[model samples]
Structure formats: structure tokens, C-alpha cells
Target: MPLRPETARQVDALVADAQSAGHVPSLIIGVVRDGALAHLAAAGTQPLPDADLQYRIGSITKTMTAVLVMQERDAGRLALDDPLRRYLPEAAAAGPVTLRQLLGHAGGLQREPDGPWWERSEGVDLAALLAGFSVTKVAHPPHRVWHYSNLAYGLLGGALERVTGTPWAQLTQERILDPLGLHRTTYAATEPFARGYVLHPWHDTLREEPRTDSRAMAPAGQIWSTVTDLARWAAFLADPDPAVLNPTTVDEMCAPVILSDLDAWRGGYGLGIQLTRDGDRVHVGHGGSMPGYVATLAVHRPSRTGVVGFANSYGFRTGGIGPLGHQILTHVLDVEPVPTRPWQPAEAPPPADLAPLTGRWWWMGTSLDVSWDRATGELVGILRGDRVSRYAPEGPDRWRGVSGVENGEVLAVLRDEAGRPAALDVATFVFTRDPDSEP
Candidate 1:
């Protein structure tokens, strides 16, 4: 279904405002919910920005590289902790850095390759990239900090080639773009692509930016995409398909491994993905930039909703490109929130074993409730009425927490002299039938 007329107007207004403020040649924005594009709008064009028109996604390409890396991990080709030298034995300088460190941008490699800014200049091949690697090439020690290294991703692509004997671009097409049906995404600019430009600070004149093939650094930021394709990618990040990539693996990729914003902690880096705190909601996504293009893709996972925005100008003075997607998507959510469905009775009764554990128990003078989710057939543990954890029955008298505070913890059932259920040992905290019972 399309957005309401008033809501569409609001979205258009937001994009138009951003385009005017940023003074970009053109801008396009798209929003998705529940794996579907809910809204698509463009500003700065007379007719309208076509959803299929391509725009440089820049470092957003890193997200796809990360997914490909995760796919190799899921297939058991290598472990995340394996050192880079395990695959590329030639890089003695980057030998000690692990795949996990590179994925999380904590390997302390320099921010870019050893040439004249790979983003603006013609990219060198893997051999040239690796040949420059030396002990002094490292800016900081491994695992020192989240350094945002494009060079890391370039190395990842090279490592993948060694492991699979296939090129990075072809591997990506086979594993991701084709699987996801993202026909609009490609390694280079195609027809109907937006022309990138650098916005003049004082005047409104714009200078066209050169287009270069990032041969080796392509994994870092070298793809061209459209709002439509980006919206789909955003949805994939929010709710991934088990066929293309495991949802658990996606979760691992989104987990904050290091803080990029340091003390502020407003922004963090996961395994190639980026996490940002916007008010109470934390968004999982990545931002991209090259010489003349800026783009962003963000998803509010809880809502299964995401936003994508692109600007065809570099160094946007108004700073709209950074927050444009979030602002537009949040506004859409605010006006047209995802409708809630009424609760329905479970298909079957709670398991008989749940009877003994159901209802309220006392834990250090506080109440803990154990309930069964018939829909998922998992145990829902609520502490003091609010903190919730979901558990799966592990074995006899044992339940393992799958989420929340009890994650990875086991809840064991204690029995009395007569073999009657007595107390609960959750995360090593004793919960008893009586408030005053001693551990």
C-alpha cells in the first residue's frame, strides 16, 4: 500500500528541505518496513528522482563485503579469529591481525591504502596493494582502536580471492546481489546514473567529479546503487533471509565490537557494520562517502523498518546527508507507525512441565515470574515484572537462556527431599517458593 497523501507530502517536504539545505545536485530517499518499500521520494529534480537511478553508495559497499566474509565463516572456510597471514601469507606486516579485528576496524591498519587516496585515484590491483604492506605501514598497533580502515576491507577482498579462487565482484554477484534480486546494484555506474558533483561553498556552481574503478579497494567503497536497491538491502539487514545468510550471523555482525565515537559512544562499529544511537532507539547500518557522493542506510531493527538516502554532492555544508535518512524514516514512523495486531490464543496449551515453574517465585525478596510462550514454545522469564529473558529447555532440569539478561546462562530446577520442585537457580541467583527462604 502507498503512504497516505498527507504523509507523502511530509516526506517530500523533508527531502526537498534537505536538498535545498545541502545544495546537492540531486537527492533520493526511500523507506522500507516488513521487507517492503513503504515510501520512495526524491527532491531537486523537476519530474522526480527515479527510484532506479543509480548513485554511488561509497563505503556502504563495506557492508556487503562484511556479509560475504560472514558467509565464508558460516561455510566453515575459516574462523573469525584466524590471522590474516593464514590466508594471505605474503602480508607479514598485517600477519598478526585477525579476520575478526579487520572486520571490526580494530586492526589499527592505516585509514586508506598507501597510494594517492584510492577513492579519488585509480585503484591498484591486490598485488600492488599487498606489496606496499610493511611494518611501518601500520599507523597504530593491532586492536588498538576502531580506526575505520578502508585498507582493511581491501585486504579482506584479497583474502577471499585466495580462499575461493574467485574475484570479489563475481563472488558478490553470486552470493548476494543475485540472491537478493538487487539488479539495480552493480560494480560500476550504469545508464540512468546520477552525476556526482562537489558543491561550491559560496556559490551554487557544481563541478563534476571523476569516476574511477577501485580495482582492489572496490570492497571498501566502489559500488553504485539506487534508493530502491538500498531499501531492500536495509530490509535484509533488519530481517535477513536464512538462505542467503543466517540471521544469527547477522546478529553477530550488528553487535557493537568497538566504539568509534569513544567517550560520546553515539556511534560504534560492528563487524563492518555501523551502529548509531539516535535518542532511545539504536540504529544498525552504515554510512558511505567518496569524492562526490554521500549515502546512508539505517534500520531500526525493533520495528523491522529502515531508511536510505543519497546525495550527489560532496562535503554537504548543511550536514543533511548524515542524518537525512534517520530523520525521514523516523518522521514516517512517527506519523504512520506499524500497526499492532491483537493477541490470539496459543495453538496449544502450555506444556505440562511448565506448570511447576509457572506463576511467581521470590528472588532475594523480589518477584520472578516464569511463563511459557506457546507460539515459540520457549520459557519467558520476567524479573520484578519487567526485565524479560527467553529460554529454551536444554535438558533434564536445565533451561538455557537465549536472549536478554539471562543470555548464555542456565536455569536449573531444584528439588526437595520428596522430589518435589522447590526452588529455581537462575544465573546463580536463588528463587524460592517462599520470600524468606535461605539459599
Candidate 2:
């Protein structure tokens, strides 16, 4: 469905104001909902960009690289805990650094490769990168802190190449880009791309910035993408498609590995994704910045609403274009909130074996209610009124908590002598049919 005109206008005003006030040469944005582009808007100087115009999407490339790595993990080709040196022996210095560390920026690697600035200048191959890499490159002990590392991704791409026997670009193209139908997203710039430019800090004048192949560092920030394609990608991140990547693996990737902004506690880094908070909503996404280019992709997983934005000017400070992109996401949610769908009744009941487990129980002398969920086909535990958890059978007389409290913990069934249902033992706490029963 199209956005309400009032909603569209409000979002447009935000875009126009950002363009005029920031003096950006060109800016474009796309609002995504349920893996579809719901609206698009553009504003800037003369000749505003379209949804298809590509912009260098800087470190957002890391998100894709992280996805690819997760794909390998799912396929059993690699594990997150596996040491990097197991694949790339050259980096024996950070030998203990695991793939998980590289994806989460917890590898303690130096921020950039040693030599000149590769963002503007040409990048070297993995061999050249490894030659300069030493123990010093492992600046801090693994898991010390969240240190953003372009070098870590470079090493990941190298490791991926060796493991899969496939080129990084080709592997990404086949695995992620092509499957998602992101035709406008590419490893290299295409024609009619947005010319990246640096807007003078003091004046509105623009200077074209150089674009170069990141080579081995391509996995770090070499992607060039359009707002439309990026919006779709953001939507995918919000609600992953099982055909491309396992949704569960994506969940693992979004789990906070460490907090990025410890004080505000508003920002964090996941296995590979970036987590940001605005008011009460948390977005799973990443921002991109390269010379003369700024871009962002943020998605609200609950609402599955997202925004992909790009600007020709790389003029923003530490945040780059992230603040604006995040604001746009928040705005869309505010004015064009997703409509609620009517709930449907279940067509089938839970398994017959679970029939005995449903209904009232008691835990720690507190009343507990248990029911079967038709939607997820799991057992739901409601304790003390509000604590809800979903459980799935793990073994005979045992069920594992799938979500909410006691997640991943086993709920062992204690049967009566007659083999009828009795009390449940979970974490030393027992649940019985009698609410008055004391522990």
C-alpha cells in the first residue's frame, strides 16, 4: 500500500530540510516495509539523485561480509569460535583471534591497514597486507574492547577465499547479492553512479573525491549500492529470508557482542551487525562512510520498517550520515506505522503427548499457567501473571525453554509413581499442580 500523502509529505520535508541545511549535493532515501520499498524521496542541489544511483556504501559492506561468514558457519564449513590462523596461517600473530572476533570488531586489530589511506588510495592484496602485519597489529588482547577494524575484515575475506576456494567478490555475488535480487548493488561502481564529493566545511562548494578498488580490503567497505537495493537489504536484515540465509543465524549475528557506547548504552556491536537505540526502539543496521560518500541502513525488527539513505557529501563528523538515516526510520514508524492484522484461530492443536502438560501449575508456591501455542506449536509458560516463555520438547520428559525467561534451560518432568503428570524441575525450582505447595 502507498503511504498516506500527509505521511509522504512529512518524510519529504525531512529529506528536503536535510539537503538544504547540510548543503549536500545529492541525497536519496527509501523507506522499506516487509521487504518492499514503500516510499522513496530525494532532495538536493539541481539534478537530484534517483533510487538507482549508486553510492559507495563504505563499512556497510561489513554487514554483508558478516552475513557471508555466518552462511559458512551454518553450512558447517567454519565456526565462529575457530581461530583465524587455522585458515590464514600468515596472521599467526593474531592466531588466537576467532572469526567471531573479526566480525564483531573484538579481534583487537588496528583500525586500518598499515600503509597509506586505502579508502582513497588503491588497496593491496592479502599477501601485501600480511607482510606488514605483525604482533603489533594485534594492538590489544582479544575481547579487550570493541575496536573497529578494517583489517579484521580484510583478514576475513582472505580466510574466506582460502576456505571456500572462491573469490570474495564472486562468493558474495552468488551467495547474497544475486539471491536477494539486488541488481544495483555491486562490488564495483557502475555507470550513472553518484559522484562522491566532499562539501567544503566553510562553503557550499564541492570537490570530487577519488574512488579506488579496496582489493583485499573490499570486504571491509568496497560495496557500491543504490537506495532501493539497500532498502531491500535492510528489510532482509529485519526479517531474513530462509532461502538466502537462516533467520536463526541472522539472530545470532544481531545479538550484542559488546556495547559500543558504554556510557549511553544506546549503541552496540553484534556478531557482525550494529545495534542502535532511539527512544524505546532498537534498530539492527550499519552506517557506511568512504571518501566523498556517506550512507546508512537501519531497520526496526519489531515493526520491520527501515530506511536506506545516501548523500554525495562525506561531510558529516563521527556519525557520518547515520543520524539522518536513523531519524528517517523513526519518522516513518511515527507517521506510517504498519497496520495490525487480525489474528486467526489455530487450525490444529498441539501434539497429543503435550495434552497432559497444559493448564495450571505452581512454581515456588506461586501460581503458574501453561498452555500450548498454536502459532509456534510450542508450550507457553506464563508465570506470576506476566513472565512468559515458550518451550519445546528436548528429550523424553524434558523440554527446553526456547524464549523468554529460563531460555535454553531444561525443564525436566518429574512423574508420579502411576506415570501420571507430576511436578516439573527446572533450575532447582519445581512446578507442581498445587498452587499451595511450598518448595
Candidate 3:
């Protein structure tokens, strides 16, 4: 379905605001809904008069890299938990940093090991870049905390190269871009790329910024794409085709792994995407920032709605893109905004038989609390430190929660030889009921 006129106006208003702010020379915005390009608009200016010029998408490239890694995993070529050293022996000394940790930004690595290479244009050999690892200290133990690190993704790029014996750029093209028919998207070195611009902080001049050669950090940030191309990418994310990424795998990528409360934006970090909540809606996507450009791409997966925005000026920071994207979504959906709320399980009143699930669950070495409300006849699982959530009875010994991070998921309690509830499986997390609780 096409976007309503009001939604179009909202997009135009945002572009106009950026233009009025005077730093943005050009912007291309696109919206995709239900597997189609619902709307696409280009305002301001591109160096040339053509509409096909490509802009550097920056860290958005990380999302693509992540998807490729997931593809490799799906093919049984790799595993998310596989140690980086499995592919690159040199990284063996870096300890037990796994590919999963890198995807989640939980692999204790520096934000940028060699510093700001884009601004200085200081190039380093691949070996020197890797050797700098010695100076790179882990901020926290693996998976304990989320520390955004460009170097970790750079390492992942190296790991992918070692595993596939191909460059990261080529891997992305072969695995993702080509399959999706994104003819206009490619690495920066590829032709027809837009020249990024940086507005002078003090002066009213726009200076052409040097294009970065992100070979070292290529996987972390180095891809050129157009609004049209990105819309297609967004569509895939909203409703993935198994040929691209298994729907289950895509859902896993969107699942929140680390919680964050920054500014007024409260959300979590998924594999390569940011999991954000706007009132009752949840969105998954990533933003991009390079020397002279800032871009945002986000999608409400359940609604099949996505918004893509790009600006030509760098150093222009506004509380990231989540808020603006959310506004756009709200306009499109024509829904009233509500306060953000954590996902909660449903409640069942007393007197129903609740003997099936009474015990414990474990995921990643953490135990989850499971109990049954005998009076209400409901099964509940507490995500360790998380608030209690009620599960709705599905069918004999099966139940499902309200589906907020774990939507469409079913939990089943396993029975022992004595027909006692001994283990419970809730989607991905598996829990073993306490032996003593077993009746």
C-alpha cells in the first residue's frame, strides 16, 4: 500500500527542516511497505543532476556484514558462537571472543583501534592494524556488557575473509546485494559515488571531504548505496525471504541482546541492528555516519513499514535517528503515541490446572525462574532480573507469552520418566525445572 498524503508531508517536513538548518545540501528519503516502495523523494541537491548518485552508507555496512555472517552460519559454514580464532589463528591470542560477541558488540574491543582514520587519512598495513590488537584492551568480559567497537567488526571482516577466502566487499556483493537485485549498491571504490561534504563548523562553507578507504574497517563501515537500493534492503529486513536469510535467523538478529537507556531513547542492541521501542511499536535497523554524510534506515517489522533518510553534511548530530524514524512511522501508521513499556507476560486467573511448568530455565549460563500460579492456573517465567511474565495456555502442556521480544514463541515443559515437569523450552532458551519442584 502507498503512504498516505499526511505521511508524505511528514517526510517532506523533515527534509525541509534539514534544508532550513542550512547544512544539508541534499537528502533522499524512501519508504517501503508490504514488500513495495511506497514512497521515494529526493530533495535538495546532488553534485550532478542525476538521481542515481550513490552515497556512502557508513556503519550501515555493518548490518550487511552481519547478515552475511548469518548467511554463512545458516549454510553451516560457520557458527555464531565459533571463536574468531577458528577462522583467523592470529586472533587466537585475543582470547575467546566469538563471532556472536562481535555481532552483539559484546566482544571487548576498542571503538577504533588506530584512532580516527577517516579524519586523518592515515593508512596502516593490515598486519600493523592487527598488531595494534596488543594495545587494544577489552573494556569488559565477553558478553558481560555492550561496548560499541569498530575494531571488533574489522576483525570480523578479517575472519570472514579467512573463512571464505574472499574480500568482505565481494562477499557482501555475492551474498546479499546481487541476490536482492540491488544494482546500484556497491563499495565506495566502485563507480558513480557521491562526493561527501562536511559543513564548516564556524564558517558557512561546505567543504568536500576526502573519501575514506575503509579496507581495514571495511566490514564496520564502507559501502555506497542509493535510496532506492536501501529501500529494497529494508524490505528484506521487514519480511526476509528464506533465500536471503531464514526468517527465524532474521528474528533472532532483531531480538534485543543488551539493554540501554541513553538520552530519552530507551532500547537494546541486536546483532547488527538497534532494537528501539516507540510507544508500543518496536523497530529494527541501523544508522550510518561517515565523514560527510549521516543516514538512517529503520523498519517496523510487524507493520512492514520502513523509512530511509540521508543527509550530506557530517558532524550534524541530533539524538541519533530513532526518534525521527519513529515519528515517521507514527505518521504512516496514524497511531497515537504511548509511553514506552517493557514487554510483560499475560495473566490468567486462578483455579485452572497449573501443574505442567514449575521450575528453572537456562540460557547462556544464566538461570531463568519458572513457576506456576496454582490459583490462576498460569505458567510464568521470570527472565532472571526481569519482571514476571504470564504465559497463556496453548494446548496440552504448551503455552505462549504475550510475545514482546519473544513473539510467536511457544514454550513446552518436558516430562520425566515419572511424568513430572522436568524441562521447559521457551523459543530459544531452555530451562530445567528444579528437581525439588518436580511433583
- Tell me the tens digit of each residue's lDDT in model 3 across 342-423: 8666464333345344555666656677676654555666776586677878898788885444546788767889987767
Model 2 Cα shift for residue 388 (angstroms): 1.7
Off by over 4 Å in 1: 1-5, 46-48, 417-419
- Encode model 1's per-residue lDDT on 25-88: one tens digit a residue: 7888887888888888787862246888888999999999999999999999989999998998
Global lDDT of model 3: 0.74
Best-fitting candidate, scored by lDDT: 1
Report the alpha-carbon TM-score of model 1 versus the true structure: 0.94
Give the worst 10-residue stretch by lDDT in candidate 2. Answer: 315-324
Provide TM-scores for the models. 0.94, 0.94, 0.74
Give residue 220's error in model 3 in angstroms.
0.7
TM-score of 3: 0.74
Q: Which candidate, 1 or 3, would have the higher TM-score against the true structure?
A: 1
Model 1 score (lDDT):
0.87
* Runs with alpha carbons beyond 4 Å of true place in candidate 2: 317-320, 335-337, 347-352
